[model samples]
Target: MSNYKFILSGGGTGGHIYPAISIANELKSRFPEAQFLFVGAKDRMEMEKVPEAGYEIKGLWISGIQRRLSLKNFVFPFKLIDSFLKAGKIVKQFKPTMVIGTGGYASAPLVKVASAKGVKCVIQEQNSYPGIANKFLAGKAEKIFVAYDGLERFFPKNKIIKTGNPVRQDILNVSANVEEALEYFQLNKNKKVLLVLGGSLGARAINKLIEKELNFFAENNIQVIWQCGKLYYEEYKKYENKNIKVLAFLNKMNLAYTAADVIISRAGAGTVSELCIVGKPVIFIPSPNVAEDHQTKNAKALSGRNAAVLVKEVSLDSRFEKEFKSIITSETRQKELSKNIKKLALPHATKHIVDEIEKILKTL
Candidate 1:
């Protein structure tokens, strides 16, 4: 039993929360004796998700700084101070050996406090372009694990480690039975499937565009596997047709990925990592609601390499079908995209991140 404790902080969205939990799970697997704790914003998704993932979590009063001057901005300083103090108290009580921040508003205060306490601290940055919190803590962070390059523009070169993004193991195991997957979704065997995803809560812009062009699939005789997300499922559920399967969520993403001919998605970092592992041709519709426009940057990294197509939110309705047809209809384009995106997969991201932690322990 390794008698060490670690603190993990990340929240607000699933992109930030899931990666933090994945790394925590890896560490716990490697050192079952180590105690772990997660810190997240009080009302954020992580408050529920981290606990459901079978870990203890503390809530912070912290939230992201508003782009425009809102009433919330007036209390931002107080919230930061309170969160910092609370995180400091938690660190003191826990006496953790290491602290890991996965990049969200709550992570900033917790990791900052831990670093000040001289605890070994690291951060996992999921995107090519990092959030304001990650960028703020870059210098203080003992090491920085990033999913892409040019982060040196934001973080120190000496501290940055390119470990890529961690995804659910099941998602990578899509190499299993394609016939079974098609049957599981009850999808047509002959029709090319177009899987549309917009993260967990969902994207309104993506939802509206798909609703506006609902007939496009029938017109083209294309099969659709749409993960409408929880927020929009009730509104969009009525549009379900023989050629379309609308799901609020799918536990068997491996089946969904295996059955899809082309993917239409919001380009969150974790999703990009999973898509790369699934090796499917993708059209990225980066959500504009996220901080720092990180999703767009993440999409650009692949689209810039000709590995995927990028459809901006504003241009989605006009360009989605054209781009969709090009990829879905052309086997050559699909093959090229699959091969190119696979080059970016890091199936063993957890292994590398764990190795870095061990290296830190040895140096001590």
Candidate 2:
């Protein structure tokens, strides 16, 4: 059992990939002799990121179907068939004791093939609304780890386990790093800090909203740490100054969380989970472009509980400043938000997930 081999399949975005890495890392800490192999889509970030985390990864020629009809859509069936064959080969060769899918189209083929061949499958879903891949794989999954309630609508009631999303280890200790985090960001202690995140690739709508509000922020005496994303960096970098720190991406996310007094962010499930741990006052502007508007759902799950504020992208022009001003100007409001969000933090989520993984490992 100590020498068990595990296959983890998920990718497409940081939300999916990072959770897989976190789970694998926790499993490794517990069972040093365990073997792990990551399976991701070819040409995706996971191919680069997983290896950087000291794990071996294989890439399948797979991509999600494009909503609009195109040449890629026409070849979708071929890609699906190719992925199935390659995934079956990998499962046959690896002979993993268990396969875990963290929800991406790339994960479906591998998880499907492995389960069919009698390998146990586990699904970790990050969103309040499960993705097509996880939904399709639900019946076959032995256990479905989820962050939100009400997922029984999509998954089997008996199979669901309400373990929150696994967050970066750094996030669990962010409070201890505040002084160093402020120095790392080179910010003034006297001024309020507003941290803005548009996710890893960046969100066009968020960047535009930030750009339009630069003057407003300065007038309100708030300094900014804006992670505008790589795609939008060039356009937004010109706005950076002594008061405005614009980063294409944040390598030290824990530090960013530590330094901020208030946060404005996209509500990707992974980001929301980390934010809850950060426990700062937050204004969540979910990306409207994602699948099933799940980002909005992720945000509402918190805002509904009064843990964070949710503002739809469509209403940013009308409500952004009002929402931002309310949180920034009111100390009591900030404390209440921070306190409430912290109440929702599952600091031991990684351990809880691995505990479940251990239970399954025993069964195997």
Candidate 3:
């Protein structure tokens, strides 16, 4: 097989960054001689994360338009034009045979430039509701990899493929025993474990809600594995008691997933994919501050299928306790949620997406 050059672009959040990394890793394993380049927004998390994943990356001077009126909105047009010109230069110099985008502001320019150059481009849409960047690129993309059904509304039907989202390889083969995981986290094996996740940067609403309910969890004999995330760890670390283990981040998410009987989490695309694979009963608290209110749409997709419970951030104060109590108190409900959610797990998503990419390249 001949060596191929490829460019991958995505950023802004771990949701976009991790999927891009996962896809790159899969491609590297399949094509050992492949040369890879990652393009991302300058100063974004992807600039830091892509290199850490052992890939060379270039950053574009780009950012998303803010929802509310701000000074950033006024400069959006100039940034977009500059990013497009820069992206065109990178694509011309790199001469990549194909470009793949997971979805972010950085991806918009790179994929657009690649497509204009007559290079094959593929985009992966991780959510049920597509982001503006992906939706815009979909028309010119050779293939559109999606995690959910009914995306024909956003992309051309002929170009759409239901390949799911690429998740961390470590999570795909989670084999930790429940008892071993409980012991590893230094928690009681007898008490039910409630794992709380609010993404890597953390959710202010979820963190505050968990703080108020710490005593209730203790009284109910529930052991807590709270990942307060990096941003909120300092503010909430004082709540760490015998029943609660607070962490800024959990590197060994497989252990945490194995240890948990139930989960309280935000409904980011990557998290939702991992949770489906973990097969635990979960109460989703979707972050409201995201673009297109996509997190709420993601949570509703699973909840609509009777796979998980959806609790809006605004309703956390009144609905959290009642919703959580119902699941924790009933084994039948827990089992039902677990079984239904497991049905949604596309364990071979990374491989399937790569297969589509290869098919598209062959046609090209």
lDDT of each: 0.88, 0.91, 0.92
lDDT by residue (1-364, candidate 2, tens digit) is 5988999999999999999999999888888999999999999999999999999999999998888878999888999999999999999999998999998988999999999999999999999999999999999999999999899899999999988999988788765466787789888888999999987778888889989999999999888999998999988899988889999999988888889999999899998998998899999988888899999999999999999999998898999999889988899999999999988887787788889988988887
The candidate with the higher TM-score, 1 or 3, is 3
Tens digit of per-residue lDDT, candidate 1, span 1-364: 3877989999888889989888989888888898999999999899999999999999999987788979999999999999999999999999999999998899998888899989989999998988888998998887899889788899999999999888887875666577898898888898888888877777788888778877888888888888888999999999887888888988788888888889889998999998888899999999877777888999999999999999998887678889988887889999999999999888888789889988897776
> What does candidate 3's lDDT look like per residue over 228-304, in tens digits?
98999998899888789999999999999999999999999999999999899999999888899999999999999
RMSD of every prediction: 1.3, 1.4, 1.0
Rank the candidate models, highest TM-score first: 3, 1, 2
Order the candidates by lDDT, highest first: 3, 2, 1
Assess candidate 1 and give its TM-score to the true structure: 0.97
Candidate 2 segments whose C-alpha is farther than 4 A from its true place: 175-179
TM-score of 2: 0.96
